[model samples]
Target: MVAIELKIGSFKAEYAGKMNLYLSLLDRFERGENENQSIGIILCADKDHLDVEIALQDINKPIGVAEYQLLLSKEELQTLVVNEIKASTKEEG
Candidate 1:
């Protein structure tokens, strides 16, 4: 299982704590006995790499933080998807 949290602004230290809580809950209640541990992904509109690094340094969970863009036009979005598909096909080949 993967838990995702989306934020509109920059990354905050508290976000990591929130995600940790989510992962814990999922592991306790939702995860199956044979399943692997839950993972977490935090997506923010902007983030500082150093801040994210520090925030997750001491944590043992499989969590990751990434930035997202909201300003892409429809054409740009389509192009990106197409390119990603092409890249993935090449890898599979």
Candidate 2:
């Protein structure tokens, strides 16, 4: 079984500690003796790549940090990006 954590806030080192605790608990109580090692994923709304790297440096278990996106239509996202670029350009000008 896999353990998944979803967070809408920034990723932090403290989250790794929590993941470790959860994995440990799953292994002890949830996983069967012959089951594959549990997998852990931390899906956050925002994450600093460098911070995530440093946070997972010493972690022995399998853990991954990834970002999630809202299910917006492609055109909507494109429009948002174009508007942002236009705003930025206008401000710069």
**Which candidate ranks first by TM-score, i.e. highest?**
1
Which pairs clash in the backbone of model 1? none
RMSD of 2: 12.0
Worst 10 residues of 1 by lDDT: 69-78
Candidate with top lDDT is 1
Please give the CA lDDT of all the candidate structures: 0.94, 0.91
What's the TM-score of every candidate structure?
0.75, 0.73
> Tens digits of per-residue lDDT for model 1 on 14-87?
99989999999999999999999999999998999999999999888999999998788878988999999999
**Global CA lDDT computed for model 2:** 0.91
Cα deviation of 77, candidate 1, in Å: 14
